[model samples]
Target chain A: MCAQKRAKSDVGEGSPARADLDRTRAVLEGPEIGRALTRIAHEVLERTKGGEGVTLLGIPTRGVPLARRLAERIERVEDRSVPWGSLDITMYRDDLRLAPARALGRTDIPAEGIDDRVVVLVDDVLFSGRTVRAALDALNDLGRPRAVQLATLVDRGHRQLPIRADYVGKNLPTSLRESVTVLLDEFDSRDAVLVGPAKARPAPEEEH
Target chain B: MRHLLSAGDLSRDEAILVLDTAKELAQVSGRSVKKYPTLRGRTVVNLFYEDSTRTRTSFELAAKRLSADVINFSAKGSSVSKGESLKDTALTLQAMGADGVVIRHSASGAAHRLAGWVDGAVLNAGDGTHEHPTQALLDVFTMRERLGHLEGLRVAIVGDILHSRVARSNVLLLHTLGAEVTLVAPPTLLPVSVHTWPCAVSYELDEVLPKSDVVMMLRVQAERMKDAFFPTAREYSRRYGLDRERFARMQRDAIVMHPGPMVRGMEISAEVADSPRSTVTEQVTNGLSVRMAVLYLLLGGSESGIGNQEGQA
Candidate 1:
């Protein structure tokens, strides 16, 4: 979904037209997404022993708001605020040279820092797992965490790297030609997971 | 975006994009690991035909921070001293598979000429009296950092306008960024074509200081002057120099800037240069960020994908 927007701009005026929205189907609605995130927040608490020494770092674009939402849920349940920030992985991507230079996103590490703390990386969708790979490289530069775990709202399985998410909201089996898009109310008008025909050429390596 | 040959090459949006990119790249420097793997395998050659301390080091450091393999080539000790032509030197760098070439030459438009010879991106460090785009970029970055925005900010560039590449680049870039620029210099030091530029001209520094938000003092290039552009040093200092008395005439929040290697008593007073209003030191640090943005914007992408992707929101 994100790749199409970039591909459209890359090709400029002569680019292939956008995929038909009417042909797409919503896999997860707003309520379903909320419930999944609530469950993931509880699972994070369970795994980290009531969320002690844990920091949530979101990958940019869609991942940021998802991390904030998870932090809010964790705060409501535990009656305490959780440290959360956005981590941009544009500088660490392997395919940077394949495409044009990307505009850098914000990387706001919490005041407490991530050193010796359990870092949970949250993203909207996990596909080829390359974005996670890039995020891990970006995390190494910031500070040494005690351990790093991956969490995503949706896991549309097409793993390129030997990576697996620790906390997944939905386990979706998708074809290579299909595009999985996770839209939130923060960025887009609606909050739903849509499945549609691949727009532009399929950038299988793009995991966002 | 392929090569930053001149500040004039940048439009309003393009200039803003570079500044914005520099703002994000600035955060990387504060990290424990002050490097990015973006240009891991790329090669950047720092080809210097002229002598420099800040600009050469700044470009080298910026390339290194991005993890690009850097090759520093200075003309003093190199084959250029043995009568090797610029084309021959460029061909050698081309053979080395350079992805980017940062050039500082004594000849004006040297970077533009090098761009024609090499397949890699050519960055103008400073041409003879043409332009120092990166210096202007860092200056603008420093202004935006301190003043919050560039739009409608009053900038007064004072000193040797005829010989200063910094002045030319700053005038072009600051104007593009929507700042109101006024060049303050003596009649002899002012360029003949200064009236044609997109800026106001002022003869008295004292008259412009009170209305200025940024007072950029250019170094009086004594080496470049064959004849007398001004009278004695003391006489020029009394008239055009930015002393403590002249500095006092500036607005309360106004800043005094000098692109480095500043002549202490000639152009800017020592007290004002060391004062809180001075951004001399900050300009050096900001130079690294601005150069990184230029390098990343030039070499971070494919050759064909240059202009299409930089304006991303």
Candidate 2:
């Protein structure tokens, strides 16, 4: 809790730490996440057949939010709570050196190891396949799983890695020179992915 | 629909078309019915791996106004809390049937990954310290709204250019429209090779203040302080903050701009932010219009009807 507090501001109105928030927003007043979750939860139920032995592991931050929603949906649908856990794979990343050293998000292991359990990895974007690989390694450290599945909202194509998404809300075939971004109402008070031309940002030291 | 991914994907003509289209979308916002039947029966999902409100709201409102069903999936409280992978979460959204998605992630290319996996249109809100195209578009829209044209306007982008995606996109868009861009920040806050850009560079905001027709300020993230990005926030504020003194030093008619939630006592002063000369609110208002334009054109509307070669639609 103390560590999380250090990385993220204590939530409140008009906090000085709000400066850390890059953009201002009317976040809580904007829209709903529950409906989307309920819809996703229904999809997961359809795929897994009543959520009898399904497990959901949300990636830290936003992934956890979606996982909780799906879990609630699963519980509501099947009258059973499949195991839910929040995993933080910051230490497991391959490109940690590319940027600043970040404060770790957190990793909570389910009491049950994923061995033989249908494990679904959840994160906000399916880029590079590196985070999923890191999650796999972290999951290996935790326990064996029966199967691992993937899900995302948008698929902006141009993969450097061979990874593919199984379930996608939208398929956006794009160029290597383009970028697709998703913004949510919780962290971001608006909900829409934007497509724009990619402009290479020179590293700071590369400025004219 | 395709991803509104990068400026490189667009020719100069395509870029102006988006601006021109946004002008038409602006009309829709003022209507008694802000809703359009253009994107009816379509589902737009916002999937932010990063934290943002302004860009998200712009896209959300844009989609809603277009009559598309909107779904928001933030990475803060659900499966993200339990460590579900990005691939998994994306697949979940796909199964749920999302037609288009707007994404914002801290990693520079997280949006690229999402674009590859899903079967819908993708839009890049922002990815890391990379690019915020709509912010740049709305900013330029605000400028053009006031100045009548972007050609030959002397625009100065001040403050932390090093970590500003807004600066990157603005430089590209502004230069594309024939504006003379001067990036002002400390030596520590600039990119390594700025001359490659069609813009000028300066270490002092005051030196260039008088000549600039438009002055855009970027937020200074104190978190960058963890890496010694600058000596002190006080030193930075002293050097770069658009306080009453420095703001007074600017061209009298020149407007001040920020992609806000401003840090009250930090990068910009309350007086300047609240001043009649400030275009911040206008930027927000224009963001929805700019985003609506993006959704419209990229969603398959004719570009010729939206904007000309340079916003003379």
Relative to the real complex, the DockQ score for model 1 comes to 0.57
Per-residue C-alpha lDDT of model 2 across residues B1-313, encoded as one tens digit per residue: 3566654455566666666656655755433345655566678899987777888877998898877889988999879879998888888888988877788887787767777788766778988888777788888889988888889999999988888888988998888888899999999888887778778999987898889999998888655445777787888888888999988888888999998878877889898899999998999999998887777555433221222122111
A65-162 per-residue lDDT for model 1 (tens digits): 99999999999998768899999888888887777666777788999899999999999888888889899989999999999999998898878899
Reported per model, the fraction of native interface contacts reproduced equals 0.71, 0.00
Write candidate 1's Cα lDDT for B1-313 as tens digits: 3778899888777787788889989997789999998888899999999999999999999999999999999999999999999999999998989988899998998988888888788888999999999999999999999999999999999999999999999999999989999999999999899999999999988889899999999889988889988779999999999998888888999999999899999998899999998999999999999999889988887652222222122
Report residue A200 deviation for candidate 2 (angstroms). 43
Indicate which candidate wins on TM-score.
Answer: 1
Q: Considering summed lDDT, which 10 consecutive residues are worst modelled in model 2 chain B?
A: B304-313
Interface root-mean-square deviation (Å) of every model: 2.5, 21.2
Off by over 4 Å in 2: A1-208, B300-313
How many clashing residue pairs appear in each of the predictions shown? 0, 108
Q: Please state every model's RMSD to the true fold in angstroms.
A: 3.6, 23.7
What TM-scores does chain A show, candidate by candidate in order? 0.91, 0.71
